[model samples]
Target: MHGEQMAEEFPVVGLDTDAREAAELLASQRLPGLIVADENGAPYTVLPASQVVRFLVPSYVQDDPSLARVIDESLADQVADKLAGVSVRALLPKELAELPVVNHDDTVLEIAAIMARLRCPLVAVVKDRKIIGAVSASRLLEVAMTPH
Candidate 1:
């Protein structure tokens, strides 16, 4: 199937949007993920809520007062702090193969192959070499169920 036909309306968050807001939006929308856009409305990074959780939750496992204090903070503050020292670029997958994306006319089989090969939950669908929407793994499965 073509990427345009396979593409579904995907949620987006601006770079200026705080991580907490982004996290909350993800939860509220029940989306598989969100596409982070730049100031010019260009796709920058695709962030999963799982990654947001990872960014917020402390990595250490201890019973120290300092750690406890840190963990007791609000989600917004916690997310802001995490983002203070980080950028969207840092969260991107190291290899392009790991960052699944498809052109507007790409077939469903091609998308499925990329998703499987890259272990991505969704693949961005590009129109005119720009991200317009995404095709989730579930969506791909739905299409595959129908005989061509």
Candidate 2:
């Protein structure tokens, strides 16, 4: 199987997209992550749901997870506020993860390797320098586990 063969249309966000909206999308769709496109519409980076959740947690809690146990439910409900008025770019870590990309004709094994090496849930499949679609980790696993 090839990348395009299994590729599914996936959501793509921009660096300047509202963080709250992005979070809402993730929550509503249960997406593992988003493909963030650059100004030229090429893959810039991935915005994983885990990263957003990490950003929501207060630094103090991250420093000492024990503090999380102390936080009350009321404050927990306001965690989404942290994302208010922020852009996706601001949510990115200081050092970005490698862009998980594959050619349209890349083999399934190739796609799997890129996903495993990057620890990403999605891989953007590009053709002629433009993103056409994406092959998700679950889709790859499905193909791998299924007998031809």
Candidate 3:
């Protein structure tokens, strides 16, 4: 099957979207990641759940994860405040990874290769440089595993 056949309607956010709202969407939907779009609504970058977790964790705690154990739950509750006025752009890494994308007609194997190579959980399926839909890693595996 091709990308268009496998792609599903997925949630997408823009670079200027509120980080808190994005995180809530991820949590509420239990998404592996959120697809981010540029000003033109084209595929930009993926904001993985893991990346959001990383952003929430204190830098010092990240440096020494054991410190996380000592931090009180109250502080943890307040930690979300950090994202209050932050934009999705602020949460993104300084050096961006290649956008995981596939053409509507790209073979399933091609989509798999891009997902594996980039370690991204979701890939945008585009037609004419605009996003049509997204294919998740689980969906790709499910399709690959199905008997022909």
Candidate 4:
């Protein structure tokens, strides 16, 4: 399958979108991640579910899993407060490893390679420098496992 065939339309979020709002969208949509678009609605970067979790959970909790056991219902709200004013861009690492991108006509194998290299959950499919859709890593695996 080609990228265009495998690509699934996902919601795009702006760089300035609040982390909490982005998290809500991901949860409500049951999406693996969301595409971060530039001012021109062009693909810029990806915000994977793992990245979101990392941003939400405190570092101490991540360092010691046992700390998570002490998190009560009330404390959960406090945890969410951390994301109140945080933007999507602020959650991203300063150095980007790669931007998983593929042309609409790219083969599934090609897309898979890019995704693997970048360790991204989704890859943007572009046509004429504009994002047309995206293919999740799960979709790429589905295509790979199918006997074409």
Candidate 5:
């Protein structure tokens, strides 16, 4: 399937969404990520589930895996506490990487390249300055592996 076809299966979120809410949506929907839109509802960025997890964990813990052992398992249940009042934009890299986006008519190959370069599980598909949908890495793989 092409990008627009694949995008129909995914969901979108706004840039102002709370980090904790986004995380919960990712978990509950079993999605790789969500398409983030600007106030105008134009596709802006891709927020991957991995990024959310990285945001929840302290940088020191991420830099040193051994430090994770010091925290009790119960800490996992308190992720919301750590993410309280944090917006999705705050969790994004401060350097401001370009948001990965593809046209609705873009080929699977193009979508794959964007996902690879961005290191994100999904890419936003847009038309007329609005998000049409999202193309997920897994969906691309499924199309690739299917018999032609």
Candidate 6:
């Protein structure tokens, strides 16, 4: 039930990485989320695919190819503009409820309770305030349904 026991290794992407690269990583890995980290590997925020999609297509803008061609015939500028000035930090979902981070010593039930109350699908595990892994809601469900 220890946090380490519940923790599952997840991918970490640098905050400064381009949105295109992040998109590729998520698509290639088939992960719903990736950890956002600083240059020194310090945790900053979590990037979910939902937010990435938002940056790609703004609600107000119609993705019309003809209009895009008129704006920038090459279309490179259009793509670049969608991601310009957008670091991982800026694109992260701000509606995240309390970020449930627990030490490796915490119990599974404790972590599960936090996730349930916060309605978060995952909880980041930390040691010395540095992220080590995550405990997903699915893992907690498995533990709960397993026979003791």
- Give stretches of model 3 more than 4 Å off: none
Per-model lDDT: 0.72, 0.91, 0.93, 0.87, 0.81, 0.72
Q: How accurate is candidate 1 locally (lDDT)?
A: 0.72
TM-score computed on alpha carbons, candidate 5: 0.90
TM-score (all chains, Cα) for each model: 0.71, 0.96, 0.97, 0.92, 0.90, 0.70
Give the deviation of candidate 4 from the true structure as CA RMSD.
Answer: 1.5
Which parts of model 5 are misplaced by more than 4 Å? none
Error of 4 at 27 (Å): 0.3
**Ten-residue stretch with the least lDDT total in model 2:** 91-100
lDDT of 5: 0.81
Error of 6 at 66 (Å): 21
Across residues 16-119, which tens digit of lDDT does each residue of candidate 3 receive? 99999999999999999999999989889998999999999989999999998999999998988999999999999999989888999999889999999999
Regions more than 4 Å wrong, model 4: none
Could you give candidate 5's per-residue lDDT for residues 1-148 as a string of tens digits? 5677777656777877888888888999888888888888887777878888888888989999899888888986786687788888876766756788998888889888888887888888887767877777877898888898
Can you write out model 6's per-residue Cα lDDT over 3-88, one digit (the tens) per residue? 98878897777867877777778789777667777788766656767668776754444555455345544554465367665667
lDDT of 1 by residue, 1-148 (tens): 6889989989777766765566667888887777877787766656766666665555562334366565644654655466554555455446434456788889888888888886767878888767889998889999889887
User: Which runs of model 2 end up more than 4 angstroms from their true locations?
Assistant: none
lDDT score of residue 18 within candidate 5 = 89
- By lDDT, rank the candidates, best first: 3, 2, 4, 5, 6, 1
56 Cα displacement, candidate 5 (Å) = 0.9
TM-score of the candidate numbered 6? 0.70
- Which candidate leads in TM-score? 3
